[model samples]
Target: MRRMLLTFCLLSLLPVTYAVACLWDSETLEQERNKFPGTLEVITGNFPRHSPAFYQWRLDDRLNKLANDPDNDRWLDDVAVSYEKLGRHSEAIEVAESQLQRNPDRYETLANLATFLIHDGQWEAGLRYIDRALEVNPDAHFGRERYQRLLVQYLLQNFPDGQVEYPLAAGDRIDFPTFLVNDQPPGEDGQPPKLSIEQRQAAVQGVVGMMRFSQHDHPVLLEVLGQLLTETYRPKVDAKQLAARCYLLLADSAASPATQAAYEQLAKKSLNLQATHKSGSEGQMGLRAVRRELSGELAAAKKRYNSIVLKEKRWIASGVDVEAAYRQYVNSVQW
Candidate 1:
């Protein structure tokens, strides 16, 4: 009877022992878990035995091990990216910043922080970091592209009023207008202020200079710049020339067949305008060659470009060197 009672008591104590063991493991895991505020909440809400949180917890252990090792900073990037994937942007930013303090020249970490900042709506600061990343490694293709995109997003959000202020020269500021209008009408005073062609050109140059400094080969930025140039120069400058430049920009940046077709249609319209206006200037000639190349008329394009390269030294009105432009065209079409 005493042996039976002893076995029963041991079995009862087995449940207590298992409970104690579970509590100890839970406490240890809690201590090992990331101390970031939202981490626990996320883990609790989707509490599976082996959830993302569980995996992340394991990753954190590795990260902790490598925390003081500069040679293993890539693990920090991995942890930051994991946090970002979990939508813990704040924690991602924190990790990126912490790693950057140790190695300020980490371009990848800088980009990661910039991305998180942009995602968190801190666009201005994000752009600053992106600029820093570019300064750190100008040859970073991905960083450059991301910087262009983030810049466009920042401009779109902040400059929705369609007005951009830029400097033409030192201490000479200009407020360039970006309002698209089919025709320039009189102002509210019934007497429109006539801006000279020089003034219009200056404004266009200022905006272009700003974009050039930003390293904008991006399609979206090109599109925005095209619109701004067209709007700023519409009635003040030659319409065909304006259309030609816009068409070239749009065409060169077009990535898809549909987009290429749309820009081609616009270029055709410019060609028609050139015919109507009887403006057979060097700009028109260069645009014609470009259009031929785009239409797969390689022989005609080569013939036209060869003629331009041999005869025309420059297209001064548009500030393009004919020979140089022809070389670029050849390079683009050769592939």
Candidate 2:
């Protein structure tokens, strides 16, 4: 009786939740607003209902239209991709999966479903699809390499903590050296080495610095130099060139996370500015007190910050990318 009641409750909640999910909102409506700029009220419950379900419901209609009409396969890929982009991962997965069912060898749909599943954190499910995808035709898509990398990353993330005393798991077949040899081949077990506590601390600091240079008007060279110095020597990034490349790559806006973070920073920064103020600080600290303060203390504080900054100048010599030049300024500590 209790199990039956629980099942009934869950069944009842389904439609209730689904109904709420259907309600259009300021966020959703606003995102769509730009799909057709200048046509603010151009869509909604009125015109053909650009409902979230439209893709599932009207896919047939669109495909029928495309069949009689000449259009690129991109038309279908676009619809699936767009839905996935909108956070409708399940919907995207459904559409892509349905298409794959009809065409078992469709790498695009299978790979895309695998992506949506992984991004949604359905790791086991995602891998299952990926395995099926491989069986579909192993070499069908060269891009599967990226999926394998992601698979390695995911496995590493899920590696059992403290399960065994060995530093590296059996699946972590490759040591740092092994991976380096095979272009950082993922351990057969799919796990990345668990960073040490010290390494974790450095990574946190490095990522924060990355955030600052990424968002603020700070010099990229200096930020990268400082971060790499701390990470490798202080924290210890043994792969100097690889780390440098990662930082430079992020700074260049050539990579996705870097590009997204950069633009978001730009947008947020564009919205902020120092406030202008109207006059008020003249208690004229009895000229004696003012003189005492400035002459005795203010100069010291100024010199400290100045000294810290001055120490950074030596790195300018080898160029931020070079080690010998920066090693002295940053000091050689294990990152």
TM-scores, all models, native as reference: 0.32, 0.32
lDDT of candidate 2 at residue 297, scale 0 to 100: 37
lDDT of 1 by residue, 99-192 (tens): 8888898888987888788667576777788788878876665234343443445454445453432211013321123222213676679855
lDDT of each: 0.49, 0.40
Q: Which residues of candidate 1, in runs, are more than 4 Å off?
A: 1-61, 64-71, 142-335
Error of 2 at 120 (Å): 1.4
True-vs-predicted CA distance for residue 323, candidate 1, Å:
51
Compared with the true structure, what per-residue lDDT tens digits does model 2 show for residues 168-209? Answer: 212444322223234344456996434444443343343333
Candidate 2: residue 85 Cα off by (Å) = 2.2
RMSD of each: 34.3, 27.2
